[model samples]
Target: MEKDILEVERKHLSNVIKECDEKHLLEVEDKFKLTYTYDAVGMGENRIPYEDVKRLSQSKALLEYSEREQKEILNHLKAYEFVKNEAKSTKVFDEEKLKDIHEILVEGIFQGGCYRNVNINIFGAAHQPPDHIKVYDRMAKFFRNLEQFKGNPLEKATYAHASIAKIHPFVDANGRLAKLVLNYFLIKEDFLPISIPLESRETYIAKLEKFKIEKDLTPLTNFFKDLLIKRYEEVLKELDI
Candidate 1:
């Protein structure tokens, strides 16, 4: 967290916000919501088309479909909406809040919010996540550390992302849930929400692997900082600022 880098990022972010008036903010907000939903859910093997994603995001009434593709899009849309709403609140990132977020993401994909009871290991991960039985305890330690953690919002959110992913508290949607929570806190702190694009999935996984193995957050912090900068720059371009 170099002072100079943060200062520059903040400057660009402020410009992006100031440049986007109310109408532009609304337009950018819709675009951002759709972009993030697509970026997140498009990582699956049965990826939905961009047009379908945009259409789904614009609808209010939940469309029911037996197809897995339609179901996945709706799940992500619901989860994204939940995160956006939760970001407006001033709640602490506690166990209950974490479970709520997890439930929102995994509502139809799996059992909503329960931690995994069976042991699991990531396929090619550099380090093993905590055992299922130890998941609760590890998360407790994480909450304690977060309470005392003093860092910039990006740093704290990075730590939050890494710690929760390493713990692997839930059986499914752990990564997505962690990302939403990180963005929740980031937006709560007045920083723009970051969407880790599907194109960067490998790099994101690598950074998390490094974190789990070496306890080094430098790579992930840089990753998020760059995303924030990209988001701001994109806003500027969209608004012709």
Candidate 2:
């Protein structure tokens, strides 16, 4: 059943791209601006208004603000921009690439990409994150495991998303960066990027927590499958399919 849905989605996406010329393809990319905003809100506590986000994304330096709300919007926009550019790459995922994406995510806010040097706690969970000192080695093990992972594209990307969050390598922005990497893998495999909506934030976090506690990936993978299906359905609807 899932395979059937995936085949339909694959054809829908192919048709959309086939239907568009160069100019319309560029417009399609622009359509993701609203997507980025929703994704940012999904990962953030202080939500930016939709209009402000649309305006903020337009200005590189023409508009500036010192407020936390504005800063969150700007930072997320930067991270999404990195995702957009990286989606164009054919590069394989690695630690260096992870750091580069983290740098883009937290630029001007803090020195990012470097693994956390201090201990931290996850709210609402008792499982202690590995010592910051072990992050490098742990991350090495992660990529090694990824190389050994034998699964479909959605499974791999979903596992990547779960593992990155579990590792919590960076000082901050782990969630956002992990999701971006998730989409990176998905897009690289020609799958539509899946954005977990803000409305599902609680369930999303709970799914991650379930993975952390049970060491079972089924729940997380299932969550991702639903999101992926929803994402494909949205695009197919836009095409009036």
Candidate 3:
């Protein structure tokens, strides 16, 4: 019943998108892209104001943000641009592209685009990541499984995000990387990008923990579906369609 309701909402959103003015749709999409950047960055615990993010987006001038915050926001914006462009092109999911995205995200902050050399913990989470030594082989198998995934785009994307989080491939920025990859997959599949809001931080983390601990994806998948529906409704409201 839930899946059927989501399918109905998806079809309605699709029809609305198709009927909306292209220029207006593009404008709304651009706005949502910035929102996604802000929300995604916030999720990483960089609590910069949305206005600051907007200003930074328009000009590179350093706002009141500290140097560290500025760099983080800039890199996130760059990652957003990179993912958007690649999704529109012939690019498909590959390990290299994933590394490239990570590199863009953490360019000046830390060593980017390379796997961690030491095992890590999720702080307070129930799922501990695999040993660093196993990352390569684990990620290889992950890619193989991803390639063989037979579910719809939404399911595949949820799996990708959860799997990456479980693998915890990088030393830092794992959550941000997973979210960006989620958007990448969604955009590649001709869906709008989602911004997990800062207000939903606890719930978002809880859903991820559910996946990490119980190997159940239904909670996170449903969470993402709700986000998509909200985005579609926002676009429709903005366009008065």
Candidate 4:
């Protein structure tokens, strides 16, 4: 959360993931074996790769809130220490949890879950979204159907995130919300939280566009899995976990 050059790092995995690659990111960075645990995924940079992760790793479980909300989210995630059963802690994730996650994120800050009736564009350009009625049903199912995904973690995440963005569920914070939802799944596992930078939004959008239109997740999946592998390698040395 501290501002620095490292904090400003950006990633471009939008190739397969519907959301911007760097929109939500886990800050951990380190080197490790290049092996990846996800399925049928390929890795790339300055290119489309790493669609999304479904392992419930901590990195993808975070909600993207303002500074104050970030603190609240951190506190809430940390509060899991009080729970006796680990699996019970995040296994029952639902919309209420999503709301709570968003609530905590915007706890003392503005730009929270409040939706804007006004129309907006994807990447603030052409692809303008239609009215609420057009997007609501799809958006509602987007989160509801996550439990139905029998695919591997990456596949579910890739599907969920890409679908969410495709619907453009929220008016202003679709990307943030999508990232937050993705991270919530990541945390149920144990990976660190990650994000995409705003400056890199262009590349992120370009890649995201491919996923949106073509429905291909290889690029996004590859980007995230490789990052996770790299992060796992780095943190493995530091935390003895």
Best-fitting candidate, scored by lDDT: 3
What C-alpha lDDT do the candidate models reach, one value each?
A: 0.79, 0.76, 0.87, 0.46
- Encode model 1's per-residue lDDT on 1-241: one tens digit a residue: 5566545766776776775688888888888887887777665454666677887666733354335566666777777777777778776678888888777776666777788898988887778877888987888899999999998888998999889889888876777777887888788787888889988999998998889889999999999888988887777677765
Number of the candidate with higher TM-score, 2 or 4? 2
In candidate 3, list every pair of residues with a backbone clash. Answer: none
* Highest-scoring model, TM-score: 3
How far off is residue 104 in model 3, in Å?
0.7
Model 1, total clashes: 0
The candidate with the higher lDDT, 2 or 3, is: 3
lDDT by residue for model 2 (144-225), tens: 9898999888888888888888889988888888888888888878887777878788888888888877877888888988
Better of 2 and 4 by lDDT: 2
How do the residues 1-241 of candidate 4 rate in per-residue lDDT, one tens digit apiece?
Answer: 6652222221222222233233222222211111121111111111212232221123534343234423433333332221213323745755555555445434454555544456666545434555666665665676567867676665566666667666765543355455555554554554444444434456666666677777676777666565555554444444322
RMSD of 1: 2.7
Per-residue error for 81 in candidate 1, Å, reads 2.7
Q: TM-score for all predictions?
A: 0.88, 0.88, 0.92, 0.55
TM-score of 4: 0.55
Clash numbers, per candidate: 0, 0, 0, 39
